[model samples]
Every structure is written in structure tokens, then in C-alpha cells.
Target: MWTNIQAKRPVWLAGAAIALAALAAYHNSFGGPFLFDDEQSILHNPSIRSFSTALTPPGGFGFTVSGRPLLNLSLALNYAVSGTEVWSYHALNLLIHVLAGLTLFGLVRRTLALPVLAGRFAGQELPAAFVIALLWTLHPLQTESVTYLIQRAESLMGLFYLLTLYGFVRAATAASARGWQVATVAACALGMACKEVMVTAPVVAVLYDRTFLAGSFRAAWERRRGLHAGLFATWLPLAWLVATAGGDRGGTFVLTPEAFAGYWLTQFEAVARYLQLALWPSPLVFEYGVTPVTAWTQVLPYAVPVVAAAGATLWALRFRPVAGFLGAAFFLILAPTSLLPGITQTIVEHRMYLPLAAVIALVAGAVMAALGRRVWPVLLVLALVAGGLTARRNADYQDEFRLWQDTVTKRPTSAKAQNNLGRVHFLRGELPEARQRYELAVSLDPGSAQTRYNLGLVLDATGQPEAAIAQYAEAVRILPYFAQARLRTASALLRLGRPAEAVAPAVEATRLLVEPAEAYFTLGQAQAMLGRPAEAAESYRAAVKHDPAQAEARLNLGIMLAQAGELAGAREQLGEAARLRPQLPEAHANLGIVLAESGRLPEAVASFQRALELRPDYAAAHYNLGNTLLRLGRVEEARGHFTAAVKAAPDFEAAREMLERLR
Candidate 1:
């Protein structure tokens, strides 16, 4: 019993060390704000804001087909618990990552202890597994997947992938391991709900069985046909998800020889880059610029190492099957992204999250085999260096400004990074700085409609309406189907008093499916400017219908209904607008006007008071309140309100005339 306890202590201590190291490395990341896709996937995504919507098929704003239901559900739970505080989400991401690292430790240890590899790794399994897991968890390249809130999809999927493999290994080792086999299949299904990358789990598991447990593919299949069949059948959910859910509009499955060749060549360079980063792991970037290989000459430089790797993998399969298994796992995990065309991004670090496990395992095993007992001190030094680097990387994600600044610094040619940096400036109200960044982004990627639109937004904010309109026009020209750009053009035209010009783009915008509410609202503004109240009212109603929480739309619709003598409808719309946005004085003031018109004197007085309480300098609210008070024969109060309105707005002739009359 004493010997058995002594043998178990090292494993427990190792697990504890991994957990503590992960927490320490990610301590700063817990406060990191949402960056990039996190805004669309979590922050502004209404679908994950509620439990019911999160559990159901995704709908509402920001629902991308890449919407992983299980990942979304986790985010929803975080929202429910902490309500967008950022800390809870980061904590959960770190927890998932730690669990994945633990699972990796278990899987690798079990694999090393198997009959096939046990002889070669005897008495060194624990240390080798611990080193691999430690290196992987602390590696700087993993910060994007672990610290960036939105990339939780990658880490979460990786966790399930590891769990599935670990369960399979456990089942293969045990005499009656039906429960472990069932757990493995369940884990595969769960992984499918997390991300599409889980599609490779079943294949990797079968390969693991063939290489380590059953000695060959045929033997593994022959022994566990039913179990293998169950594993393959789990792909049904994944297939259904891919078919039904809207995939990223960027990637395509269609393969042309030319396109395939270019993508394949680009991936070779990417693989070389990944290997470099895996070894050095410095100056990690958030985004990488895509550079496709258009010619064979461009591919020649990268082809050598890729070819060497392929030959080594083939050679290992015949002589050293374990190495082949590791090699196969690395390529199989990377195959989806590498071979796929239209991936938008050619190289991304987070894509290496799963593949790194195999490389780390092989490296750690080689180191242990060579150094024997002396490997622990070397691993300790490496882990400390890697953990320190990881912590520093997490600090870069402390906020969007720091994150994008670092991204642009590292990847200066990345238009996305420049544009996002511009967004940070724009959000801070530094219009000139924002414009400069936007200009840089536009110059870098002249064909990107988004960068052009971003430039237009800064131009409009800086009072250059014509220049803004030109940028918007360029954006629309570049991407003719861009509804938001058309809407922006219409808005800029309206700002420049060209209501007639605004009408065309505004109408065109309403025809597009994207942001129809915003388009309809812009159309209503243009129509109202052109003296078409009836059409404007219809457009406003459509805007409100599409987004019920659109307080500005509801307020405009109410004002239009009031002008059309539909007082009851006006009252309802204004009341809803006020309820939706309690802080908007305009909503309360408009509600007051409709109430006054409908002869609800007491409610009108209360609404006007509420509006004034929200905005003490609101001249219109004061004026409307004065008129209501004068009608109710509150002579002194009416005079005071009229005076206040005239004081708030010196150009208010109506308030001046009303004050004189009241006196």
C-alpha cells in the first residue's frame, strides 16, 4: 500500500502543477475584453443572450453558421451568471483549456504505457506525458485559443477531442470497458456540437487503435466492428449541422486543380511557419495576412520540407508505426483547413491547437529517451520560459486597443488589423487617428469594402460629408451587394441635404436582407426629408417590425403616426420606445406629446416631467410641457416652463412667443 501510494503521488503532483501553471499564465487574461469575432459571436449576438435562444437553433442578430451550439450554450451560461462582465467567460475558457491539458496528459501517458510503446518508454511514461502536456499548455502559440474569448470554440472542441481519444484508450486497455466505449462515442458527439474540427476525432481514434492496440487497421476493425460502426455513425449529427447551419460564406468545398494547387502550396509555407513558431514561439500575432502561391516557382521554396515530412511519415509507417501514428495525427488534424479552399485565412495559429499535441508528445518522448532522468530539469526551464511568454502574450489581450496595436505592429500588412485598430480609435472618439489608420488599411487592401466603409464612417464623423459619401460609394462599387455601405451612402447624402440622391441608395438598401431594419430606417429618413410622410411612416413601421428594440425607429414611427392623425398608434409606439430605452429623453418627450394630444393630461404631465428629469436642457420637452400646462390653466407653471424652453434654445421663436403670451 505504501509503495502504491508513493507511485501515485507524482501523478497527483504533476496534475496540480499543470492546473496552477495554467491559472498563473492566464491570470491577466481574465480581465481581457472581447476582441474581433467575440463582438459578433458573444457581445452583440442576441441569440446567446437568453437560455431558450441559446438552446434552440441559432437565430437573431450575429448568428453565423459557424455558431457552435454547445459553445454558444456555454457563453449563454456565462452571460446568465455574470452578465457580460468578461471575467466569468475567461475563467470558463481557462477551465476548459486546463481540462484539455489534463486529458492530453492522460491520453499520452496511457498511449506510452501500451504494449506496443511501453518497452521503449518503460519507467519514463509519466515524465514524458507531463512534459508534453506542460509544454502544450504553456506554449505562447496557444494564447489565441485559450485567452481570446471567441476562440473558445477551438479550445472547447479540442477538449472533447482529447476526451474521446482518452476514453478510447481506456476502453482498449480494459477487459469489460463498455462504459468507456460509450463515453468515447458520447464525447465525439459533444465535440461535433463544439466545432466542425471534431469531424477528425473518429478517424484519429481508429488510427490510434490500429497503430497501438490492435496492431493493424484490419485487426482493429475486425475486433470491434460494432463499436467502430457506432463511432462512424456519430458523424450524422456533424453532417446535419454542416448541411443545415450556414457555414462561413468565405470557405468553399468545390475543388479546381489550379485553386487546389495554390492552396496546397500556400499550406506548405504555412506548415513551415507553424513549425518555426512551435520551436521559437515568440511575437505571436492575432491575425496573419493571406498570401496565395500563384506559380510553381512560389511553391518550390516550401515544397522541400513538406515533401521531407511526407516521406518521413511514409517511412515511419513501415518501420516505426508509432511515429507514423503521430505524424498521421498531425496531418489529419491539419488536413481540413490546409486542403480546404476559400478559407479566407490561409494561416492561423489557433488551427494548430490540436496538432501541437502530437508534435509535443513526439518531441518530449525523444528528449526523455535521450536524456533519461536528466530531462526533468530541462523541461522545468522550458516550462518556466514558455509560461512567462504565455503570461506576457495574455497581457496583450488586456483590451482591444492593446490587442489590435500589437497585431498591427506584428502583422503590419494585415488590412484587418489596421481596420480594427481604426475601429478602436473611432470608438474612443479620436477621429483623426481613426482616419489615419483607416487610410492605411485602405491603402494596404484597396479592394476591401469594409476598410473603405470604415474610412467613410470616420470621414462622416469628422464633418466631411462629401468625402464620406465618396468612400461609401467606393465601398458599394467594390461590393455591389453590400447593403450597409448603400445605407451609409444614403445617410451621407441625407446629411448633405441631397434627399433625392439619398432616396435611391436607401431604397436599394431596403431590398437587401442584411440589416433591413437599419436600411428601412434610413429610407424613412430620406422619404421624410422629401416630404413623403405616408411612405416614411410605412418604412418606419417596417423598421420597428424587424427590430422591436429599435428605440429610434419606434420614436420616429410614433412621430410620423402623430402627424398622420393616428394619435392612439402614436401613443403606443412612443410608450414602447420609452420602455425599450428609458434613458432616451426623446422617447419620453414624444410619449408626452402623444399623451397630451390624446387628452391624458395627468399622464402627459408625468411623461413630460420624466423627460425633463432625464434631460434638463431639453428645449422641445419644455416647450411641449408649457403648452400642456397653459391649456390646464396652470398660468405661473406654464410661464416658467416657456421661459425655461426659451433659455435652453435661444433660437426657439415658438417658445419666445409662447412665453410672451403666457406673461
Candidate 2:
């Protein structure tokens, strides 16, 4: 609708309006919880808990291969203030999104100064800039970048990306004694730290020099020599940092130069896909997986739009946009992600967070220019309507459950969607329904580890421990260091009374990841079973150290201490276990046994009484209480408990004999 507002005052007002609209649209994100990979990337991570780990290359977020230190540093800063509050994490993401919007507005405004795109605005720089910024800020597709807290790396990186573009464009047009050169390069480096996407930024800088600074090929090359020397000089250190940080090479998928070229060509189709979505954003999904670039139907068919754009670029060699920044900036910033050899799959909504800004700006400015003097009202309507839609979409990200539920509802055949939705159901105790969804997902695609792991969890819950073990075994085999599968395998083993056999897998898990409290607890139980009481105690201690809520570990540790004759330590550990799990009938019953043996008869009787209070029909507690009373010389009381125990367990020889002795 934007084809009018070609004036400075109107543009300034539109910029302010976009700022307020974006802020209002996403304010609810302050309550969004950690979702999806946030668990592995942030919550369960040990390194992020401490400041020292924040600075290292493989730092601040545990020792995983994901060494985005700048991202870790931002998370570390978030942790320093509030560890896991949903509001704090969401607030940080919102701040980054809003700030990136502001930077995008600034970049657009600065681009208007260049001769190429400025003429399209018919001499009005401000109007074209406002329309671009307004649309970009309120686009519904960007909700993923803002609402998914962990993906703030994209939004935050975009801020620096736009800053680098603005400074470089201004430098090329103004040339100002090269003073801005250092700032431009520094911004580029920071952008790279924020995300590896900045690799495409240098290309954008050259395009700005070509289109705005000097358009002819020879002049652009001549102008680029000194800037290239200065720029690449700094990029050498950035390259080193990137190497130290490391990235997923798609495991042999990224090793080929031809594959890189194929990837770039495929992104041509991807760009067309993005354009299609911009026009009609239906059936959107947060995940598209590593979508294959050149499907048989898509290879020939998708080339139509890409070919058109390419031909347009060739023909438009004589006539360029006034800002001159849109084509090169869009192409430049987008190239690393869209053209990279191997990284993510071919399509993801989050990838659009930065590039869409350029595309939207180009479209909005061009639309306003074409309408000639009536675009202001239309721009306002577009911002308001888009902002409303974006706000509506963000409501889906309120929780993982809601997000995936929406996904499955929108894309019923999407196996990933079904699997994630099943995970939400499983987390909330709808086991039967979760199993139903997981089975559907498996039927759709058996290759996904996430689906298999989820199905394993359901099987384990339904008492099919052996089947669950098999599922987890397969998952771990596929992804050897996958912490979830390894932990589940150990848990199933423990449940099947094969805890001793679980030691190997649990050890493997710890060697790979210093997390999984359940694994450590299960390992301790297995060690204790193998006659390694001392080692078991240390394992239990580590388990409780990582997760203070491990009451079972504490009680087990206490029992081992009692058996080892460490009476004081046994009582201390058991007492803590009791305090932690008041309803644990075994904890109270065991406490009574330890106390009676320690010569605390009155305390022993009371502990037994409490165990009875919690679980009145507990046969073991009745049997143990009967024995404790017998030791205390309460013959009558002992007989009563013995009678109850025998009634509770009809095959109880111990209760029958104990009652006979009392008589």
C-alpha cells in the first residue's frame, strides 16, 4: 500500500511509528520460556553458569562443539542477572530485536544519501527510508527471530550487520579521510562474533562502493584495493577466531567446493521460496529441516523466478536504486547464510531475520516511489496491520507446547512438527496421546533421532522397559554422544534391574557431557551394586551436587554409609533426604532402621510411625516397624504391627514368624 510519502518529515514520523509498533507487537515475549535447543544450548549448560568460562573459545556454555562465545557471553550476562527466569531471557531477546529494528532504520536512512537509490524517492530521502524500516520491523515472519529467545543471536547479529553496512556506505559515499574505516571494520567483526553470517558483509561493502561510490567495474575495483587491504587485514584475526570456535561441517557434506556452488545455486530457489512466503505466509513452520536444494520438480521449476531476478539485474546495469544499498546489502548480508557450503538446512524462518530487512526496504521504498505522493497513509496501514499479525503470531511462542501444537495444526504431515508436538504432550503427562503422536511421527520418518527418543520415553513410561532400552540403544548408536538417549538407556537399565550393566553407557555419557544428574545417580546405584561403596558414595555426591533435588541419591548414599558403619554420616545424609522428600516412605522406614541400630529407640519408633503415616498400607514399612518395636521390647506393639504386615502381604513368612515370636 506504500507508494506516496516522499518527504523528510513524513519519513521521520513513520520511523518513530514503526519503532512503537514493533515494541507493542512483541511485548508479550517477556513471558516466553526456553524452548527446543535452548535446553542443550543454555539451561543444562555448565560453563554458562560461571563467568570464567564466558571468555574462552569453547567457553561460557559448557564444552560442546557449539563455540559461539559471543552468544555464550550474552547468555552469561543474562545468567549473571537472572539465571532461569523466563522474563529475563525473553526480555533480552526483545531488546535485541527492537534494537536491530532501530539499526535497520538507520541503515536505510543512511542509504538514502547515496545517489543511486535517492533518485527513486524523487529527492526525498526520509520517506523511502521510513517505509522500508516500518515494514521490516512489523513483518510477521520475523516473529521467530524475536519470540524464540535463543535465536536472538540472529536479531542481535543483524544489529551489528546493519551498523557495518551504514558506516561502510557512508564511508564510500563521503570518503571522509578514511576515519570511519576503523569503525566500519570493527562493527563487521562484532557482527561476525554475534553470528558467522558477517562473512558476507565484506561483499556488501564492495557492492556499496560499486553502486554508490563508483558504479563502473574498473572504478569499483580500483576503489576497493585500499579498503580491501585494510578490511581483509582485520578479517584474518576474525577467521582465526572462527576456526577456533569451529562449526558443523555437516559431517562431510560441506567438504566439497562443488557442493558449495550447488548450495549457492540452490539458495536461488530458496530466495524465491522466501519471496513467495513474503507474499503469502501460510503453512509456515519453525523447522523445515535440511531441505534438499535441487529436488527433481524444484530444480527446473524454481529457476523461473531466480532467472527473472538475474536478468533484471543484468538489464538494470544502467539504472540503479537511489540508495544503491538494497541490492548489494541484501545480496551481501544474505550470501554467507544462503550460499555457505554446509551449515543449516536449505530453509528456516530464522534465516530471514536479517535479509528480509533489505528485501522489505527495497519493496516498500519502491512501492512508495511508484505511487508518487500518496504512500504515507498506505505505509501506516501496512505497519499497523503487519504489527497486529506479528503480535498474533507471537502468542504461539508463549510455550513450547503451544508453539509445536500450532505447528502440527498448520502442517499436519510435517514429521518434525508431529514429533515436537508429541514431546510437548509427553512432557505434560499425556502419555497415551503422546505415544499416538510419536508413532505417527515414526511412521512418517524413522530417521529422526528426536522422534525415536520420544517414543522410547513413552515406552519406558508404559512399562516396556526392554523395548525402551532398544529404542534408546538405537538412538545412541546413531548419535553416540547424544546425552538424552544415553541417559534414557541408563534409566531403562536401572528400571529393569540391570543397573550394573548400565555403568558403561553412563560413563560414556559423562565423558561426553558433564550433565545428566539421572545418569550419575543411576551410575552410583550400579556401582553400589558392584561392591564399590566408596565410589558409589562419590557418584551420589556428584549427582546431588549437580542437582540438589536428588533426594533418592541422598537416601541411597545414607544407606550405604550406614552399612559401612559410618553412623554419623549415615544419619546426616538420611536426615537431609527426609527433609528433601517428606513423602518418601522408604526414606522414613530406612531412617528408623538406622536409628534403632544406633541405639536411638524413641527416635526409631517415631520414624517408623511417620513412615506408617505416609504410607499406611506399605508392607515393608509394617514389617520394619514390627522389627523395630520388637528390638525396643514393645512386645504388644510389635505383635500389632506384625499382624498388620501379615495382613498386608499374605505370603509374608517374615511377618508370620515375627508375630509368632511376639506371642
Candidate 3:
């Protein structure tokens, strides 16, 4: 019994080492701020605010959680534990990545221990699988999926993908395969809900069975037809998700034939780059923005090598099935993203989250074959190198400024990187530097509506209203549905005091904005400035309806109602406005005016005093307090307030007249 337990020690030790390596490599990443798409997927995602909403996910496409309900639900769970502290989100992401690494270790060890391959890997299975799993887990290329919080979608899907295959392997050797088969199908379905990439797992599972267990496709299918059927049925939910998403995968995919051709051409270069990074793992980029390879000349050089590899993979499928499986897995896992035309990013490193395992396994297998049992030193060096590089990569994510700066330094031409760096600068209140970066971003990608809008915001904040309006107008021209740009354009026009010119963009903004309370409020201000009282009141009411806590909107609506002789309505709006914004002198002053008009003299005096406390020099508050006091027959107090109001505002004719009458 002691000997038997001792025999299992190495396997248990290898699993613990892989988990420890994952935790050590990502130790610094817990403090990494939410970057880029994390803003929409985890930080501001209303769907993840509750379990029910998260299970439904959001309707929009560009967000990470758009149609990925399982991914959203995971985020919701993290939120329940730690809201937006960010550490909890990073912890969950690292946990998912570590789980995937252990699953890969199990799958590789089990596959190598099978009868077909066991002869070559008999005593080396544990060591070889440990090296592959450790290197893959600590790979610098994985930092994007592990450190960048929103890409939890990638790592989480990868976990389920690995589990599906690992479950199948367990089922092949188990006496009762029913439970393992069900678990495999369940994992596949959950993976589909995490990301669209899991669509290839079923095919990969059948290929694994043919290569390692059954020795032929016919036998594999005959033996496990029910299991394969269950696996394929998992695709049904993915099909429904893609169908409901309009097959575009949330604006990331483009289906035009021309787009498909261009994207396919670009993949040759992208695949070649991924292979290079797999070996060297240096200069791992965070964002490789869309660079369409329309001309064949740009793709031909990379295409030659990639095409040769594909031909080699096809050749190996007929002769050397193990090599073929590894090659096929790499290509198959990436085929969905490579074939699909994703407009957001043409080449991203995170797509290698699972494919890296295939690459590492293939390379490690080659080393073990060449060196036999002497491959230990080489594997150890590789593991140490990969772990050190991953730790260094995680250091870049510690500061948002540093992360985007690193991307900008590496990919100077990536306009999206430049725009993000500018956003970090903007958030830090470094206006001049932010403006400079945004201008460079706009110059790099003039057609980018987001970059144009960002530049307009910098210009608007710097008091260049006309220039800001021009940028906003250009953004709207590029993307007509950009409500923020339209709203900014109207805001710039309002700043320039061209209320008539602001009206058009403000109206368009109200139509296009999702939460249009701000747009409605902007339109109300424009209408009021244009002397359209009824239109202004309608716009203010709409703003209040969309966002009941909009104190400024309620205050404006109250003033409008009081002017139109609707005292009761004015009193309600003004009271709520004051309650919502206790420090706003305007809200309390307006409420006091309506109270006096409604014959609430004592309440009116108290409101006026509170407004004066917030703003001692508020001429209007002093004047109103004086009027309310005079109505209460407190003539001495009324005289003192009138005198103070006249002193505060020399142009206050009404206060001066009241003071003279009291004297």
C-alpha cells in the first residue's frame, strides 16, 4: 500500500507544480486594472449586476458579454463576491487559466499513456506532460488572456474546451463511460456559451479518439457513435446563439465575400506570426488593430510558409497520425477566427490561449523524440524562461498607462493603442499630452470614428469649441449612429452660444442615444435658449422620465412649470430636485420660489436660508428670502436681506426697490 501510494506521488506533484506555476506567474496581475473591452463587459455591464440579467446577457454585439451568457454569468458571480474591486475579477480569470492548465496536463498525460503511444512515452508521460503544461501555463503569450480581465471569455472557454477533451479521454478508459460522456457533452455546451471558438471541439475529440484509442475513424465512430452524437448536439445552442446574434458575433464578424477574402489573406501572416511568438514569445502585442491585406503581394511571403505547413499537415494525416493530430488541432482551434472576418481586430494574441498547448506539445514531443530521456534539462530551461517572461509581461499590466504605452511603443502604428493611451492620459488630467496623443491617433487612422470623437473631447475640454465641433461632425459623418459624437457636437455649439445651430445635433442625439436623458437635457437647454418654452418643457420632462434623479432637468422643468402658472407641478418637481441635490443652490432657490408662490411661507423661508448657506453671495437667494420674510411680517429681517441682496448685486433693481420701501 505504501509503495502504491509512492507510485502516484510524481503525478500528484506534477499537478501541484502546474497550479503553483500558474499562481506564481500571475501573482502580480491581481492589481491590474480593467483594460479596453473590460469597461463594457465587467465594469459597466448592467447585465452582470444580477444573476438573472447576466444569464440573459446584454443585447449589443461589440461588448465581450454580448451573446456569451455563460461568460457573463461568471462575471456576475465575481461581482457578487467583490463588486468592482478588480482583484476578484483578476482572481477568477487566473483561476480559470490555472484550471485549464491542469486540465491540459491531464489530457496530455492520459493521451500519451494510451496503448498506441505508450511504448514511446511509457515512463516519460508524467515528465513530458508536466513540461508541456508548465510551459504553456507560464507562456508570455498567455498574459493577454490571463491578465487582461475581459478576455476571461477566452480563458474560460478554453477551460471548458480542455475539459471536454479530457472528459472524453477519461470515458475511453473508464468501465462506465456514461457519466463521463454526459460530462463531456455538458462541458462542450458550456464552452459554446462562453465563446464561439468551442465549435471545433467535437471534431477534435473524434480525431483524438481515432489517433489514440480506436486506431481508425470507422472503429472510433462505431464504438462511440452515441458519444460523438452527444458532442455534436452541443453545437445546437452555439448555432442558436450565432443565429440570434445575426451570425456576426456582435459586430466582430463581417460576412461579405470581399471581407472574407481579405481576412483569409491576412491570416497567413497572422498564423506565421503566432508560430514565431510560440517559439520566441518576445514582443507580445496587446492589440494588433485591423490591417486588411487587400493586395496579394503583402501576404505572399508569409503565405508560402503557412501554405507549406498546411500541405505538410495534410501529408502527415495519411502517414504520421500523431503529428497530424497536433497540426490539425492547432489549425482547427484557430480556423473559426481565421476564416471569420473580424473587423475589430485582425490579429490578436489571445486566440492562442488554447492553440498554444498544441504548439508546445508538438515541439516538446519533437525534443523528447530527438533527445530521448535526456530532454529534462532542455524542458527545465524552457519552463524557467517562459515563467520569467510571463512575470515580466504581467508587470506591464500593473499600470494602465504603462500597458498602453508598451503597446504604443511596440506597435506605433496601431491607432487604437494610441487612442487608449490618450484615454489614460485624459483620465489622469494630463490635458496637453492627452490632446497630443489623440491628435496623433486621429492622424494615424482618420476614418476611426472613436478616435475622432476622442480628439473632439480633448478639444472641447481645452475651450476650442469650433475645432471640437468640426471633429465631432467628422465623427458623425464617419459613423452616423455615434450618438455621443452628435451630443458632443451639440454641446460645443451650445458653448459657442449658437442655440439654433445646436438644436439639430441635440435632436439627433436624443434619437440615437440609448440612455438619452443627457441628450434630452441638452435638447431642453437648446430649446429654452431658443425661446421655445413648450418644446423645452417637453424635452425636460422626457429627460426626467428617463432619469428621475436628474436634478438639473427637474429644476429646469420646475422653473418652466412655475413660469407657465402650474404651481402644483412646479412645487413637486422643485422639491424633488432639491432633495436629489442638497448642495445645488439653484435647486433650493427654485424650490423656495415655488413654495412662496404656493403660500408655504414658513417652508419658503427655510429653503431660502438653506440656499443662502450653500451660497452666501447668491443674489437671487437673498432677494427671495427677503420677499418671503416680508410676507411673514418680519419687516426687520426682510430689510436686512434686501440690503444685503442690493450689496451683493448692484444691478438688482427689485431688491433696491424693496429696500427703499422698507426704509
Candidate 4:
């Protein structure tokens, strides 16, 4: 029994068993409408919001850091069908994490060349791999990376990272056995399609060859030179070098030589930061911001030698200790994100997600190798302690408010954290608090479009439409294709009774395919107010076609259809809209209009009652109900609704018209 339990497979199985246990401890993101980029990432994201849109070339879904069109296409598929259901998104994230966990295990097991067989009968082989992957899957530090729906880029990107590494392992094995290179090439190509971040895979492969493939350095380098060159040649992922992108294009700082120097200096600080977090992670945050580092003078270049020498020393000193290779692997994988110029922050905990496995593998392997006969007692205690810490850490990610609030508390200087905290206040309708937070955010980051846009929203809520308009306008001026900014501006114009002035920009917004349904819906409302019923009807029809599930859009479409004398078509649209959103007062009210217009007075009265049930003070629903009742000679019922309508909106023209007739 002791002999069977002492093997590599047993350890892996034990780790997997622990991970599976962790999954059941709490539901993944059990409640969330959406958060952060989920708006564009899941629901309004054009890639996912539209069908028949190409994902490649001049005009495509290019809202990515890695220029990965296929990943965007898949996410678009997620949005189109699932439509922001938290469970669906959570489930998908969970599934990807699971696959990644399994893949990590596979990669580690294969990389170690552990002697194991595949079967319940055969049992676990690579115990260290099992420990590594297990630690990876259930580590609390990784909860945000795996659970945040919008951070699909992190998890999915890491997946390709693993694939690229795993492919290198497979290629090395095949080469050793004197097999074909096709599998290796195919895997690398697939990794690129998944994420351009895997561009470092070739360099990693070369190092991996030197570290693990051969017992000696010179032989391994010789074996992998051709493969490394081939991989490097094919690794042209980031073809463009645009400095600023996304909404408001507050964009990244310019990459000047001085900036480059600061960027390089940041790597040492980041290296220290990551190492610190790896040992004792605390005060985890979603946003490290555009300024996570300070400018570095030439005097601050001390980190270059420290990190490099430390890594070099570890490599040079690892005669028989696998710890050297493990440490080296962690540094190699993490170097790109850490050493790069473009990443917003100088340090992030999630950046360690891909590399943590190396630490786990090394530590677990040491434990196994050192105290081979008496390892069980030590391993058990370590698992419990690690698992406890992980569980405690994950509790923070239960919701955005808690997470962001904690972030600000922990890292008060984090402007991004402040902005996110303010967003939480705004989303929750704490307007005064929201305004205060937004003001703080803007003060901290004057150039941030996000903060400025948010400030505009708060201003609009306080009835400062002109100021709000200016902010939104500024946002658009900075970020020419910001859909939310465009929509906000157009909606503000409509509210300000300048609906005609709202049309062209709204149309342009739709033309840019930035939330086309929202732009069209808002444009339809503007055109309707401008007395262009025909044009309004066309816009509303497009809105419904773009998002059939939008009850409000369908309600507007039905009203327009009825006005255009298409009663049957109008009724069908409104009825479906009402059925889709039984709680929506407008859909029921619109259904009543189409029903009454088609001379179905009794049915129209019922629809109006449903509308009033949802929104008792809805003047249009009350007015329409009154009209229907009056038509049916029910003076008493008609009088009640007419009175109700007049109270709901005293100055409402339609309500006034109905009440006067009823009196």
C-alpha cells in the first residue's frame, strides 16, 4: 500500500481530488448582471452583438490586446446566444479553467517525463505535476483570473501559453524518439490563433530544451536551434503598434526612450513584486492602472543586474537540482508581461498565473525527492494551509463592490481602483457618493476618458445636460468610435429636446457598428420626436432586427409600425415583445396600442391593465386603457384610468386629451 501510494500518479490524483473539492466549496460568480468590460465583452460587444460580421481584415472585431480574431469570434458567439446570463458566462469560464487545469497537468506530467500510465487501474504517474496543476487550479490568487467573465483574455491566453509550452514538450519528445515535426508546428499555429501573447513560446521552447530536454546545456541548445529559428520566424503576432486604443483613448503613455528606460527598470521592481506576491499575496486588485510604475532615472537601473544575475546564478548553479530549471521556467514565462512596455500596470497578480505552476512543481518535487519516505505528513499539512489561504482570498471576489472597495482600501493611490469604486457607487444609484467618487477619480486621472465619461453621466443625472453633453463630446473627440459615449451624447440631446441635432451623430455611431441597436433605438426616438415617422419606423425596425430581445426597442418598433398603418405587423411585434418581457410596462402599453388600432378594444384593455400592473403610474398605459374603456361604453372604468393618467403625467398631452373627454 505504501509503495503504490509513493508514486508520481498518486500525487497528481491527490491534487486533482483537492481541486474538485474546491469547485464545490462555492458557486462561481453566482450573482452578477455584468461587471466592467462585460458590457462590451459580453452584451454590447460588436463582435458578439452582430452576425455575418467578419472577424478579420480592415473592418472587424479588433477590440483586443493580442489581435486574436478567433477568440473574439468565439466570445461573440457566447454573447449572441447566452445574452449576459451570469451562469452561462460563469459556466464557460469554469469549463475553460477546467480544460486549462487538465492541460496544465498533461503538460507537467509529459514535461517531467514521469513514468506513468493512463487508467483508473494504472493510477497517477506524475505526482509533482498533479500537485502543480492542483495548486494552480484551486489557488485563491487565481480566482479573479478564472472567475471574471471579462478576463477571458487572461485565462484563454494562458490556455494558449500552456498549449505552446506543451507543444514544445511534445516536439522535444518526438524529436528524441526521431518522430515527425508536424504535430509541433500544428500546435504552435493553434496557439497563435488563440492568443498573440504566445509569441514568446519559441524562445521558451529553446530554453525548455536546454533545461529539461537534455541533461547538458550544449546538446539541448544544438537540438532546438533550428526549431527556435522556425518558431521565431513565424511569431509575428503584434503587426501593428498603435499607442492609444479603446474608449476615450485616454490611451497609454507614449513609449519614448526615457519611457522605455522606466519600463525596463520597472521589470526589477515587478520581479520583486511578483516574487513577494507568490510567497504572500495580499491586497489583490482588479486595476493597477495606466501608471503602476514611477519614472526611473539611470541610477535606478540596479534591478537589471539583480534579477538577471539571480536568474543566471540559479541557472548556472543547478547541477542536479531541478529547482534551477523550475525557477528559470517561471522567469522565462513571466518575463514577457513583466519586461514589456505596453501592459498597463508594472505589476499584477494574475500575471503570475501561468508561472505559479513552476513554483508548485519545484516545491512539490523537492518535497517528494528529499523526504521520499516521510513526505506524506509534510504534504498534508502544506495542502491544508495553502487551501485555507486560497479559500480566504477567494471570498473577496464574491462581488465587484467588495472587490473594488477592498482594492481602494488596500491601494488608495490606485486611480483605477478609485474609478472602479466610483463606478460601483454609480451602478448602485448612490448618486452623491458616485459623484464624489467620480470627482476623486477625475482628479486622480485627468486624462482618463472613463473617469470623464463617468463624470458626465453623474452630471446628466443631476440635470446638467449641457455639461454632460460637453463631457461626452470630449470623450468622442478623444475616442472617435466610442459607442457608449456616442449613445450617451445622442440620448442627452433627445432629453434636451434637440432630437433633430441628435440624429446624424447617432446614425454615424450605428454606421461604426458601435452598439448599433442602441444607436438605432435612440435615433428612432429622436426621429419620432422630429416628426419623421417613416424614418423613425425604419430605425426602430433596424433596432429590433439587431436585438430582437430588446423589449424597449420592440415596443418603440410596434408603436412606429402602428402609426405607419401596419396594425397586424405592429401587434405581432409588440405581443412578442410583451411576451419576452412580461415585467416591462412599455411593451404591454405598446401591445395595447396595436390591439386598439386593429379594433380589438377588449384585448387592448387587458393589455393596458397588464401595463398598469407593472407601472401603475404609467400615463400612456392609463390613457390608452381609458380610451379603450370609453370606446366600449364603460364610462366608470374609463373615468378611473383617465383620472389615473392625468395624475401620472399632468402635462402629458395624450393624458390631457383622454381626461378632458372622460370629464
Top candidate (TM-score): 3
| Per-prediction TM-score | 0.90, 0.87, 0.93, 0.78
Question: lDDT winner among the candidates?
Answer: 3
| Candidate 3 per-residue lDDT over residues 563-653, each given as its tens digit | 9999999999999999999999999998899999899999999999999999998899999999999899999999888888988999999
Q: lDDT of each model, Cα atoms only?
A: 0.85, 0.74, 0.89, 0.69
Off by over 4 Å in 1: 1-9, 55-67, 246-257, 294-298, 476-483, 498-517, 530-549, 576-585, 602-623, 634-663
Model 3 alpha-carbon drift over 4 Å, by segment:
1-9, 294-297, 497-514, 527-549, 557-580, 598-602
**Candidate 1's residue-wise lDDT over 1-663, tens digit each?**
999989899998999999999998888888898888787677766657778888544432234325368888898889998988998999999999999999998998888888887667666888888888999999999998988888888899999999999999888888888999899899999998888888888898889889999988999999877777778888999887766664542223336787777777788878877777888986688987566676888777777887898789889977888889888888888888788764346778998899988887777777787777777888878988999999998888887898899889988988889999999999999998999999998887887787899999998998898999889889888778667788889998888889899989988988864348888998899899889999999999999887888999999999999999999999989999999999999999989999998999879999999999999999999999989998898988988888999899999999999877755
Angstrom error of the Cα, residue 663, model 3: value is 2.5
**Candidate with more favorable, higher lDDT: 3 or 4:** 3
A best-first ranking of the candidates according to their lDDT comes to 3, 1, 2, 4
- Local accuracy of candidate 4 as per-residue lDDT tens digits, 93-171: 7667766777788887776563222231122336656666766776666766666666666677677667666767777
Every model: Cα RMSD to truth:
3.3, 4.7, 2.7, 6.0
Candidates ranked, most accurate by TM-score first = 3, 1, 2, 4
Show model 2 residue runs off by greater than 4 Å: 1-15, 55-65, 80-82, 115-123, 169-182, 214-242, 249-269, 293-295, 314-325, 341-344, 399-402, 600-602, 620-639, 650-658
Which candidate, 2 or 3, has the higher TM-score? 3
In candidate 3 the C-alpha lDDT for residue 322 amounts to 93
Clashes of each: 1, 11, 1, 6
